[model samples]
Target: MKFDVLRAHQGDKWYGVGDTRDAREVEVQHLVDRGVLRKAAPDVLNKAAPPVQNKAVSAPKNKASK
Candidate 1:
């Protein structure tokens, strides 16, 4: 079952499982040992990536503005 979850999320940042953190970590490690999944880079797992910060415009500022 654990292996199935890992396989389903082969290259995802965090497999969407509700298991405890320790259990998830162990499962991930097992998958890695079995050459089933690879660890994602730190940047890839950045859960706190800043929300899209587009500049706020009060009104249309383009040639097509009405």
Candidate 2:
């Protein structure tokens, strides 16, 4: 899992922007429990921030003309 450093901290290395850590869930939770890290806010998880092609189909526009 990923975590954002809420405060400065060190383990095997420093943790912060431009050099984020990829750690196990438990490892991240440990820091959060100790007030060292925080859950990252929700953001883009795709090639771009997306509505992702708007796949929901709409009813035919001319339904009453059938």
Candidate 3:
């Protein structure tokens, strides 16, 4: 799971404040329980947004015959 470091901590790995990193739940469950780390917000850059069509489809115009 990914977590946001709320405070500087050290374990099997070192985590600094404001750092976003991924770790196995089993490995960091203690820190998470202690509020040292919280779930990180999803990264927008990594998410793929659906393609959008901005142009509106228009019907063909007909000319009147005299």
- Highest TM-score: which candidate? 3
lDDT of 2 by residue, 1-66 (tens): 666776777777876543455678785787779877766655564136546687787777797855
* Model 3: per-residue Cα lDDT at residue 21: 68
> Each candidate's TM vs. the true structure?
0.29, 0.49, 0.58
Worst 10-residue lDDT window, candidate 1: 1-10
lDDT score, candidate 2, position 42: 54
Local error of candidate 1 at residue 6 (angstroms): 3.5
Ranking by TM-score: 3, 2, 1
How does model 1 score by TM-score?
Answer: 0.29
User: Looking at candidate 3, what is the lDDT of residue 37?
Assistant: 91
Estimate candidate 1's alpha-carbon lDDT, on a 0 to 1 scale: 0.50
Per-candidate RMSD, Å: 8.5, 8.2, 7.4
- Better model by TM-score: candidate 1 vs candidate 3: 3
lDDT by residue for model 1 (1-66), tens: 133333444244555433212236564676668755544445456468688977886776786975
Lowest lDDT 10-residue stretch of candidate 2:
41-50
- The top-ranked prediction according to lDDT is 3
User: By lDDT, is 1 or 2 better?
Assistant: 2
